[model samples]
Each structure stands twice: as structure tokens, then as C-alpha cells.
Target: MEISGIGSFLRNRRFGNYLEASFGVNFASPSKVAVKEEVEKKIQSVAFVEDDGIGAVLISWVRIVVCFVTMMFTTFIWALIMLVLFPWPYQRIRQGNIYGHLTGRLLMWILGNPIKIEGSECADEKVIYICNHASPIDIFLIMWLTPTGTVGVAKKEIIWYPLFGQLYFLANHLRIDRSNPSAAIQSMKEAAHTILKNNLSLIIFPEGTRSKSGRLLPFKKGFVHVALQTRRPIVPVVFTGTHRAWRKGSLHVRPAPLNVKYLPPIRTDDWTADKIEDYVKMVHDVYVKNLPESQRPMH
Candidate 1:
């Protein structure tokens, strides 16, 4: 079978360049296909030889080590400094938003990458902020930008992820266990109570997981339920360039500018469950459109 031009471009030009080949004579007779068989054997042997496997594993290991060390040192050093220099209340303030912002700035600068924040004018002191999930670094950026206390709605697994786990508990975080659907819903109900009682803002990723392709994943309705129950405002946040800057499969911090944009808040005062899905889709589309051309997810 012959491949089309586009197929040729995608296969041979894009990825087939790494394949092995057999260089020998080809006979004109029907029974003499030695070169073809030799080539097939070579192809099979080379096909399973992963060119990027070792490099990927080593890089992933290095990233884990670096991330662990950075999270530990930053949390410890900042907490210690805040404890020594401020009163109890002031210390809590520093530890929460201030320290987080400082940590993010330090990480970005040290990585020689800058994050630009725009559309902050739409940010309210108290509201539910929803953004596309892209990476663990999403936590730091959201906390840094939020003035009023921001509580993240994260998965239960995060409660066990190293320094992040301890900090999450310390910050009075909300955990949703998706494995048990009922339990997850109950957790969100409890979180709604906390949000209302404390007049605190919640940051949730409706997508539930980070996008490997950078495209907005299908959103879960748990966020809508919580928003409706609390009758709080919903602010849409778009995080651009985060995936390229720190992709899920790799650990090396590539230098790139990350952009965070805050859209106007949407209220649940008159929204119905039926239209919630439509509303969420619209917000996602808006985010996709507003994203910089270079950072927009390829469909």
C-alpha cells in the first residue's frame, strides 16, 4: 500500500526517521526475498529499542528529586522566618499568601522563567475561582494571586504527596476522593459549608486532572454543585504556557513565560443545573480563545 502525502509527512518525516534499514541487493526472482526478510527482522528489533526511554526515566527521576527538595526547603525556610519575625496572626498571614507568592516568584526567577498576570481587575476578594488544571505548580500561582484566603479543591491523593500534603492540611484544605463518588460529593458539601462559614474563596479545576495535550479536558460537575450550594461567585482563570513550561512527563524546568488571566466572575444566583454544563463549556471556549496562539492546545 502506498501512503498519501499527509500520511507520508506525519509518519516518515515526523517519527520514522529513527527507524533502522537493511542495505543489500534485491533479486528479481519471486522466491528470492532475502533483503525483505532481513529488513523485517531489523525493523522488529529496532522498533522495541526505545530511543527516549532511558532519557525520559532519568529526567523524570531528577525532576522528582528537585521538586521534593525545593518544596521542603521553601516551606521550612519560609515558615521559620515568619515564625521568628511576626506575631501569631501575622505569621499565619505570611505563611499563607505571602510565602506562597514569594516561593512562586523565587521558583520562576530561579528557573529563569517569568509569569505575567493580566486581567486581575476582575478578581474579587471572595469568590470561587475555577481554572484549567495543567500542573502541580498551579497551586502556587493561584495562591499567590488570590488576596483573600484561597482554598484549593484537590484530589485525596494530594494529601499524601510530600511537603504539599503537610501544607495542604495546615492550610485547612479540601480533599475530594473520586474513587468513592458518594464520598467525594459529601466532601464537596462539607467544603461548601467551610466556604460560606469562613467567607473564603475556593479554587477548583473543573477538569479534575491536568491535560497532557494542553487541551481543556471534559469538566466534572462537582464544581457546579458546590458553587450552586454556596451561591458564591465563580471566577474563571486561564493559565497559559504552563504545560510547555513544566509538562507532566518531564522534570527539567524549561525557561518560558507563563501567563495567568482572570476573567469576570459568574454568579450562581439564577443558574440552573441544566444550563451549568453549557455555561462551563462557554467559559472553557472563552479561555481557549483568549490564550496566546503559541500556548493554545492543539486539537
Candidate 2:
């Protein structure tokens, strides 16, 4: 029998079970020609499946490696250029924001992805940004939206992540130690201070971590605290389809369109810290409604 036919035979549960039974029965009958042929066919079928499985795994690894190397190379060069240019003042900040937008575009290009931005109606400078948690890409998306030097509230653990860690530190991004609420509160206070001192914008992923299901999890009140503390206007940014492109624990970069909608700023002058939960829910709901149904991650 041809090897292809043997593959089908091996895939058949009934046939496979019968063959196994036949092999067991004929094992002691060494002179049975039929038994010898059946045993040989089963071995060949098993070998073919094993070879195909191995080849698939190898190809997957090669593709993942290629994607990682290319992404790293492009990001490294972009970071080097941005660092060397180093825009500081408001005018430079505008230039930097422009650079950020360009960088976002380049990133999408490198990953073979595209991002759509909407609601430019209120792309103001002084605003507090609240977004959903998805991945490290969340920060990049924030940068993509508010290039004008926003102070990002991120985990303290990321400080140890090789090259990106050093760059994040250099950016003077806000670091939060969630394990210690007191430390987290202090971090938020310091972040607010940084915003006022630098006159910079802010981006907070209130969920604290990437949501595996793409659903907006309960948000921490830190962003609300910052908004009320600083008395700054809050801007709600909703991002969709990013999780599909690069999800947590995934290495392969999939090409997908990213949609960003920048809602108007939420004024906090009259809002109290007690009202934070309401604000958080409002933004989370907006995100859920705007997110594409097909792209929402499985729970």
C-alpha cells in the first residue's frame, strides 16, 4: 500500500484498533506474512505523522524568530533616533508628539498592521488619558495617540526588561508597585507631580494588567485619584483589535487593524475621588461598546 493510503488507515480509529489487535494476536505467530505487512504499514504511518508534526513545529519557531528579530531591530533604531533628537520644551514637545505619531505608524508598518485614529475633535494637550489594559502595546498605543510627552503609569517590574526597561526609565514614566497599595498611592502622587511640573499629559491603564478576555476588568481608582488630585481634565481613549495583533504571552505578531477613538475630556474640577468608580465604569463601558465584536478575546 502507498504511504498516503496508510496515513488514512492510521487515522481511522476502527482500523487502527483492529490493526493493533491483529499485531498483538500475530506477535507469537512469527511466520504470518499478513501480520508482518500490517506491522510494517503501521510503523510507516506513525513515522510520517511524526515527521509532519516536527516540520510544523520547526516552521512555527522559525516564523516567530524572524518576527521577533525584525521587530527588535526596527524598534531599536527608532528609539535611538528619538533619544538622540530629545525634544524637551513645549515646542519640542509638539515636535516630539509628531515624532510619536510617526513612530506609531512605523511600528504598524514593521508589524504589518494598521491603526485608525478617530475623534481628533479634542486632541488637546492638557488631559488625563484612561485606557484599557491589553499588553505593553497599550503604552505604545498611548504614545501613538498622545506623542506630546505623556507620563505613563506602568508596573515597577518592567524596569528589569532589558533594553525597553532602560528606555522606559529614561522616559521618566510613572512606575506603580501594585503589591503595596501605599506605595502605589505614593507613585500616583509622584506621577501627578511629574505631570504638573513637566506640564505633560498622562495615560493610565486602570485595569492594572492585560485582560486575557479583552473585557474591561475592574479598574483601580489610581487614575481617578490622579484626575481629582490634579484637577486635570480626563480624556477617555478606547482601543480595539490590539489584543488580536499582539496578545499577552504571545510571541507571533499578527497583522490586524487597530482602531482608536479619542473621546472628549472628562472634567474633574467638580468631580470628587468618591465619584471615581462611576467615571471608571463609564469609560469601560465606552470601550466595550466601541470594540469590534470579532476582535474581542475569548474568556
Q: Assess the local accuracy of residue 291 in candidate 2 as a C-alpha lDDT between 0 and 100.
A: 67
Global lDDT scores for all candidate models:
0.64, 0.62
Candidate 2: tens digits of C-alpha lDDT, residues 94-199: 4334434544434444454344456755655678888876754665666555635555668999889875565555555668877888988888888888788878
TM-score, cand. 2: 0.67
Tell me, by TM-score, which candidate is best: 1
Q: Pick by lDDT: which candidate is best? A: 1
Q: Write the per-residue lDDT of candidate 1 for residues 71-138, one digit (tens) a residue.
A: 68888875565556544532343245555555554444344334445567676457888888776566
TM-score for each candidate, following the candidate numbering:
0.69, 0.67
Given candidate 1, what's the lDDT at residue 94?
A: 29
Error of 1 at 217 (Å): 0.8
**In model 2, which regions exceed 4 Å deviation?**
1-103, 292-299
lDDT of 2 at 95: 39
